[model samples]
Target: MLFEKPLTLEDIKKEPFIIEHIKWDAGPKELMEPSIVPSCDGFIKKEPLKGYIFYIDTMGDKPVLSLMRHTEAGFAETLAQLDDMPDELLKEAIDESKGKGCFGMYPINEKIKALLKKELGAG
Candidate 1:
């Protein structure tokens, strides 16, 4: 389905299922350069990286897992609608993605697996 207006972070926050299942706190980040004239800061500095942000787009009849790229402004580009993936394929993808790092991969794959299981009635 098509949304009359673009979806926002507020829209994502309103979904109870997503809030309960998905890990919204973590995502890709980049290590910032250390200060040349630093004291004794042992902790590494990191900043949010530009990457895909997963959210449920409810414009459709059923809530669908949607992919969007976060921008300096906000969620901007709609990459894909991932609602129709076959159950087997989704399962395989989830399994294969386990224990993987965040670079060029879904950092929230477990959350996605949970959402998919709920959507596919597999739970």
Candidate 2:
């Protein structure tokens, strides 16, 4: 379920399982790649941005599903939770995120989708 407050780095660090899942199972290899942007002269490679991460924030009274993206400074910014997103829009987000060469996008694979749904109580 969605939490009333956005997740913080401290909240994320408290959940080791979520971190390991993202590191070993859910996170795509492309997530580690730098983002490429078209520049005036050519293309510029920048630190990865806007790649989504799934985590369970246990800071509240109950476990809350959280979605976050990496910032330019390599910190995470919490976006929303499962209950906050409609199914159709979530599907579109996942579909559109694929095959984008990891450029300011998160590639949602089958494993990631399954985990997301399971954690969100949708699967």
TM-score of each: 0.32, 0.32
Clashing pairs in 2: none
Lowest summed lDDT across 10 adjacent residues in model 1 is found at 28-37
Which candidate leads the pack in lDDT? 2
What is the per-residue lDDT of model 1 for residues 1-123, given as tens digits with 9 covering 90 to 100?
234454454454454443444334343322112223334774553343344455444455654455555543333466456656444544454355554434343333565656644653434
- The 0-to-1 C-alpha lDDT of every candidate, in the order given, reads 0.46, 0.50
Per-candidate count of clashing residue pairs (backbone under 3 Å): 0, 0
Residue 41, candidate 2: how far off, in angstroms?
34
Candidate 1 contains a number of clashing pairs equal to: 0
Indicate the residue-level lDDT of 37 in model 2: 70
lDDT of 1 at 55: 42
Model 1 bad stretches (over 4 Å): 1-43, 53-65, 72-80, 99-123
Positional deviation of residue 120's Cα in model 1 after best superposition, in angstroms? 25
lDDT minimum window of 10 residues, candidate 2: 21-30
